[model samples]
Target chain A: MEKRYDIVEIKENVLADNDRVAGKIREELRRSNTCFINLMASPGAGKTSLLIKTIEALKDKYSIGVMEADADGDVDAKTISALGVRTLQIHTGGLCHMDADMTFRGLKELGFEDLDLIFLENVGNLVCPAEFDVGAALQVMILSVPEGDDKPLKYPLMFKVSDCMIVNKIDAEAVFDFDYEACVERARALNPEIRPFRLSALKGENVDEWIRYLDGFIREWRK
Target chain B: MHEMGIVLHIAKTLNETAEEEKITKIGSVTLQVGEVSGIITDLFVDCWNYFKVRNEILKDSELKLETLPAVTFCGDCEKTYPTVKYGRECPYCGSYETWLLTGNECIIKEIEAETL
Candidate 1:
């Protein structure tokens, strides 16, 4: 006879294990006063370009470190390394996203504590990266004008998990039919506290504002 | 897809457990895939099939996936509702101050196996 299944209310999260591990990494970062950002988006959303601009703008003040988690692309990593910043490439091999364990490994490789700001450029995926926490202080995601406003509705988790949203490629807004207001409304509806920035990474438009905000945020986080 | 990586993790964990227990055949592997977990269901199944083709223990093992609906608890309303449909906000109170009660899961909940 089967044992009488006493319905025990087991309130356990599936990502709880990962979250516990992630919390450890977060504590490690906190102890060292290191600020880390997880940058996520769909492929070709100009995440690397934004990183390049941010590094160039703040390289003199803060020691920037980049951990590029890509399934195939190294072109971005190469570009970031060219800027004379400490950069590491994490080839996810065939995986679509980077987990906390992988980030921990990369952290060891980079000797992460020396960094003032560590940006983990997650694989350019709108979906998978939202599922895992890589122990970042903040999660920033990009939505290019070319991808359309409907992305906010379809991929809500990315926006929900992200602390900030970068609506990139405003320079190409004239050519695209993307509704800026609708995207902002939907994103705000999902996450009211999300910081939104409109910029063109390639054209270097409004990037200084982003860098300024980031600098201020880092200052606050440090304090 | 990344489901393959998840499958590999499951397989490795199951093998470790089986070796400790000295089991031969397996029955079912139950997984909890959250509604907003970001893992594709079809791709997980496809990866399981491909994995079974190479493994003997899981050759005929069944894959059971339980879809966990995303639910959250609102601090204002003091109730839990599906976050998959309406996220962060309480459906009744429309408050953004809420904690994610469930969802965002990708776990191997239970594994059944047999001894020789």
Candidate 2:
């Protein structure tokens, strides 16, 4: 006769464990008054360019650190380090995304105590990064003009998870058949509260507005 | 790879649960995966099978996946419909203002285990 095993109710999201770790990281960051932003987007979506612009714009006011999470590369870290900010490159060892545990390790290495703002430039992927929460108080994602406006429909979860959306490469909008309004509308449909910023990171267009908003957000979060 | 990541997380959570509940061996795990959760069941099971060998507590454990139906609610009509059948647009009202009400979930509903 087969014995029935005791069924222990474990009604928890699979990501709950990760979320716990993420919550801990967020609390630690809170004590230090550090604003953590998980910046995500598809590869070549100008995450690095925007980071440089944001850092340059805010570097004078706040001490900034960046934990660049890439599957493999120090190129972005080197570029950001050129601006003289504390930039740490996190190699995911071929993983598609960085989980909360990996994020905690990065923060420990980067030392969040002295920093006012830390940007985890998450792996350049749309799908995987959205699935995992890295304990950021704010989540920012980019959608380049070249990537098309239909991206929001294809990757709804990415837009849904993101708190802010940056429509980068607007300088190339003339060449590309990308409609900014349509893109924002699609993303807004998924996430009614998702704030969208249309800018060209390469051309330094409208980046100031984004930075100002971020500054205000950091101020609010720290308060 | 995404399935592998999820499995890893599941393993992590199960281990924690095992520790907390004092479970020596897990007989089976029942998961409530939604249709639009974006998780491929076959890949998830394959990953689970591949992962169980390393985790002693999960040795020979059966993975039971119960799919939760994906449902979308139309903002215009205020009626729910099958998400897989109708998609984002409402069939009855022909409105684009439809949002997912259910699905897009991966929850560990229950776990059968041997306690000490």
Each prediction's TM-score against the native?
0.82, 0.94
Best by lDDT: 2
Residue A65 of model 1 has an lDDT of: 93
Model 2 stretches astray by more than 4 angstroms: A1-4
What does candidate 1 score in Cα RMSD to the true structure? 4.5
DockQ of each: 0.23, 0.79
**Local accuracy of candidate 2 as per-residue lDDT tens digits, B18-110:** 999999999999999999999989888998999998899998699999999999998898999999998988999999888889898999999
Colliding pairs, model 2:
none
Residue-level lDDT for B33 in candidate 2:
100
Docking quality level of the chain pair in candidate 1 = incorrect
Candidate 2, which CAPRI tier?
medium
TM-score computed on alpha carbons, candidate 2: 0.94
Q: Residues B1-45, candidate 1, lDDT per residue (tens digit)?
A: 567766766676677666777667667777888887778899889
Q: What is candidate 1's TM-score for chain A?
A: 0.94
Chain A TM-score per candidate?
0.94, 0.95
